[model samples]
Each structure stands twice: as structure tokens, then as C-alpha cells.
Target: MASNSEQKIPTMSRQAAEALIAEKMGPDRVPRKFKIITDTSDFFRVDYNDVVILGDNPYWVKRYEKEGRFGLDDEPKYWVRRAIDLSDGSTKILKLVFHEEFETKIGGISIRCFRSPKKEARILDLVAEHPNFMHGHWVLDSAGNNVRILEFIPGPRYDQLIIDYGTDHQDYFFNYFKEVLDQYIELVTAIKFLHDHGEKHGDIRRDHIIHDRECKVNRWIDFDYNYMHGESMFGFDLQGLGNILIFLTGRGDVLVPELYQQQREVFDRLWGEDLNISYKNRVANLQKIFPYIPKSLNRILLHFSIGAKIFYETTDQMLFDLAKARADVIKLSGRTS
Candidate 1:
């Protein structure tokens, strides 16, 4: 009774199989010999000294530090450090997840600082075949820590592109916008691939999407919060995609607190008085606020964002529409040029 698709399930490699097993068994089951990478620079050092090697021994950790400080904490704990691969003598980017007993309460439950590098590694392995996903070179596992060696995708972050070219240059912005639309279609294709395999990217923020100018491809990164095969979180990824489109259209300024407050009265009246409006209604409000969105694309966006409409039941459906929109833009651009 096996369908052709089910019968064609590819055999997982030994390493990938081991990673899945290790993930299911948790961090405690990871091997002790496998070294875990950690940040040990003067500014911010990981507290745990017994388990892993400090990555910031002699190398410059300046560029590796992210922009914002972690919470009220002054220094950055998590870091992306360069490590020399002993097997090949080449350098690789090691993503270190180091939290120093930071605790916070969420939804009436106390949560402690914890890293899920194994889970991330497994998810990376699952999506490795996808062109848009960043490859996981190797996973180093220790009793208390896990280190993932990810492919160092060289490119400017999507947000950086928005900052550099989103405004002040009308022609360039339109060209870049077209490019972003193409990239968004490609992203939808990547997400379709994930959904086909029964996985969902739980987090799909703008920063996580990188446009590699060298490869001319959009790479999706950070599987830290990815959800494995599940039915409960079905439409959340669609919502994330909608947000990304809104950002790409340069209307992200509308998401600011002041702007949101300005539109709150109209939003409530239009979408009814529900304080916690649905994702679809939220997107509909976005459509209402930004009436300048092109008709061809706005239809697609509204279909995905509006609660009552169900035109895009799957990522493939959305992908098809996006591809058409991209092609239409290209044709229009050609004519204008």
C-alpha cells in the first residue's frame, strides 16, 4: 500500500542517522570527545569551562559580536567564531550557543537558559539537500554542549540590503525590489520543499534570510526554532512569509509602535473589536494601511494575509502566483528599460 513517493524515501547517511539518534537522546547522550565551541573573549566569556574549548583564544572577536547586547546583560554570550578544521586545514564558521544561567518566565512557566544545538544540527541535516538552506558541515557534541559547524555563507543580510537601498534611490530601489521579489519566490520554493518533507521553519524573520551576491542565491539560516513534522503549527509559516513580503515592500516602518498606535483605531473598526485579532486580519490591516501595493501582487498578499480567503492553501499555490508576479515585473522592467 506504499505510494511511489513514500517508497522513494532516500536513505539517510550514517552521520545524519547518528545525529537524529543523538538528538532524540538529548545532549546528555552526546559523546564526550567531540569538542564544543564557545566564546571566551575578554568582553563576554561563556561561564562553563569544563566542557568545551573557548573559540576566542587569540583570534579577533570584534566582527563576530552581534549589534545589540543580550537583554539587560552588558556582554554577548552567543557568538559565531572561526575555527580551523583539523581534518582539512580549512576554516569553518562555528555557531556557539552559550548562555550563562539566564532565566525568564513565559506563559506562566519558568524557563532557564538552554541550548538546542543538537536539534538544530538535525534540522540542518534534514534540509541539507535544499539549495536555499545553509549546509551543516559537521556537528560536535559533548555531554553539556553541542557545536554546529555551518557553511559560512558570505553575503549581506536582507535587512542590510533594505537599509542600503530601500530608499533615496527610486530607480535602484525598484530594481532591488524586483530582485527581492524574485528572491521571495525562491524563498517560497525553499519553504515548499520543507513542507513537502513535513518540516516547518518556525522562525522566518528578515535577518535569517541572506542574499548571497556571489552565488546569486537566497540562503535560509538559523534552524534553532524549527519545528519537525507537525500539524499543530500549520499556518504559522505562511504568516511569517507575509511579514517578509511586507518588509520587502519597504512598509516595515508601519510595524513600529507609534505607527501601529496610529492605525489601531481603524484596524479595530475594520477587523471588528477583537483585541487579539487573527494573523489573517492583521495582514488585511496591513493591506488597508498600504494601499499603494501593486494590484497583481496585492491580490496574492491579501490572499495569504486575509483570514476569510483561502486561495493559497499550500506554499506551491503561493509560489505559482509569486512566480507569475515576478515574471510580470521582469516584463514590465524590460519594457521600461
Candidate 2:
């Protein structure tokens, strides 16, 4: 039940993309070698029709070297290298992610650095179907391993977009933000659709929300955090949307009164009674940061924030309404100006 927006994007079938990458990589590359470095159960299926051998002595391979002491948690078990064919000189990276399953409250869920083959296939299927997010990544079947060949998306992250351009970038930023807003709406719509399809995205965060300003589009990148709709941690997805709103407003680190007051209410509801921070001081600060923010909008935000004190059972719907309200105000002001 993916939305029309979700279905509009053109994505290659997992099998078709696999076939193309396999043909390009050629045969007799890995000598039919299959490696399993994970200490977990191997519940993987192999596709002979989509088999591709990774070339020997790949030149463009680079491991991410960090300046930290190596420990059990800091080990790198994957091999990532780029390949460039000489004939037409086409290039792609061969990404291999290895992982193991562990028992958790969420059941025997995978703790992969990347997703498992089935999860990878699901991503491919999503990308093939949704092209607006600018789908360029592909997954190749290598015997039993899942090899990801992705088209590089290079740009500043959406969070950085505001900082880099600020008010001067408002017009450009508005266009970009609108496009991202559509994608974000679509993403949530898709998540709701997934919930309808008996699936859910357990982790939806600003970090996972990717935007390419140059392309004027946004994409939700990692499906590794996806899960079933009724999964224990399902509520995190909605919380993640609130986090996205905080980022979109570009009020990062500003600590507006409305937001603080709203958060205070939630804690009070959970623990009962308000905290020490005076509403007078909080309101004082909002006056300083957003002196130009319309009083009507400020009042709405404050009222909505207070509603959070009551346990925020309807915060998601409230947020969506607030966003539409803000957008409408902006539009009305633009017309008057």
C-alpha cells in the first residue's frame, strides 16, 4: 500500500539491478569463494542467476581509518573498494557489510553494520519504485554475500544547508525545503503505508533523513532500523518526526520558550508537577530569538507546547497542523508584501 508519491519513483527490480551489476563485474573474479565472517546463524539464500565475482586487487578500495584505539567494538570486517572498467571506464564501488544476530527485547533481530540480504532487497525494491528520492544504489548477489553498488550522492546535509546559507539562502532554501518537506511527508506516508503493510521504521532520525540541495530532493537512506508496525519500539518513529521538525525550523540550539515549555509539560506529566525553569525567563528568551515571529504563531506554538504537558497523545497531528499553519502564514505574508 505504498502511496502514489512512493510508487511514482522509478526503481529497478532487485533482480534486474543485480543482474546488471553482475554482468558488469564479470565472472571468474572471486573464484566462486563464499565467506561468512559473522558468528551468528546463516539464514541467507544464494541467487546463482545474479552471481558476480568481485575483481582481484581492486584499486579504489579504501577503509575508513579513524583516530581511535581499536577495540572489539571498533573492528572493521567489511571490504569496500571502487572498480573502474577500462573499456568505457565506467566505475562503481563494491561494498560488503558483514554482521551477526543477537537476542534482544525486539527478538532475534539483526545487528548488522548494514542490513541483511533480505533487507537489502527490500531497499532495492523501494528505490526501484521511488525515483524522486534520486535512487542510484544497486545491490549485487555475490554467491552468498550481498554486495551494494551505490551511486554516490554528494552534497551538504540538510542540517548544514541552513547554516551554510541562512537568510540569504531562504528563497533557495525554501524551494529545497519544500521539496524535502514533500519527501518527508512522503516518507512518513510511506511509513504509515508500511504500518498498513505490517511493517514499521523503528528509527527515524535527522541523521537518517538525507537531502541533496543541488538536486532539490530528500531521501530516507537506512532501512536497517525498519521493523514491524506493532514492534515494541514503534513509537520512536513519531518521536523521530518531531526531531525532524526541530531541524527543519533551523532553530537549532536556540532553546525557544515554546519548545522548552512543551518539553517541561511532557516531563511533568510523566513525573507530575512542573520543574524549576520559570515560564517568565523562557518567554523572555523567545522574545529575544524570534522578535519577528508573529505573535499569533508564537501563541499557537506555546499553546501546543502546553498540550504536551497533558501527555502529548496527539502531538504528531498537532505538529502537522502547526507546520501547515506556519506555511499558510508565510504564504499570506508573502502575498501582502
Q: Best-fitting candidate, measured by lDDT? A: 1
How much does candidate 2 score in TM-score?
0.52
The number of the candidate with the highest TM-score is 1
Residues 172-262, candidate 1, lDDT per residue (tens digit)?
Answer: 4355667767777888888888778766665666777877777778888776654332343446567567667755654343443443577
Off by over 4 Å in 1: 1-91, 96-115, 140-145, 166-174, 227-232, 255-292, 304-313, 331-337
What TM-score, to 2 decimals, does candidate 1 have?
0.61
Evaluated against the true structure, the overall lDDT of model 1 is 0.53
Report the C-alpha displacement of residue 178, candidate 2, in angstroms. Answer: 6.7
Instruction: For model 2, give the RMSD to the true fold.
Output: 10.9
